[model samples]
Target: MTTRTILAAAALALVPALASAECGWEKRINANTCGEGQTFDTATGTCVDQSTS
Candidate 1:
């Protein structure tokens, strides 16, 4: 196959893997529930301890 065609196929193969990868914290809004001693940070969309954050 041509180089361009091979590159296109390789890129397509990476699409699924990239899609499944967790790029960042899961998106949540106003659902501030967190485990004991942890507080949900709205800016980062993650749970952090009160002392640390």
Candidate 2:
């Protein structure tokens, strides 16, 4: 491919990295203590889990 074509392709490839998408997570724990399996909730900011106790 030509130099310009290659450069353009490279720039387009970086579009996804610049996206707002992020590895979201949530804390699923009780107010007293965090006792649960933390998981990724993309919906929120952090991972969530089932609180116990």
Mind giving the per-residue lDDT tens digits that candidate 1 earns over 4-33? 999999999999888877655575544457
Cα error, residue 13 of model 1, in Å, equals 0.1
Clashes of each: 0, 6
Among residues 3 or more apart in sequence or in different chains, the pairs in candidate 1 whose N, CA or C atoms overlap within 3 Å are none
- Give all candidate RMSDs, comma-separated: 6.3, 8.0
Which candidate number would show the highest TM-score if scored against the true structure?
1
Write one digit per residue (lDDT tens) for candidate 2, span 6-44.
Answer: 999999998887663443344344344533566555555
lDDT of each: 0.78, 0.62
lDDT, candidate 1, equals 0.78
Q: Report residue 26 deviation for candidate 1 (angstroms).
A: 5.3
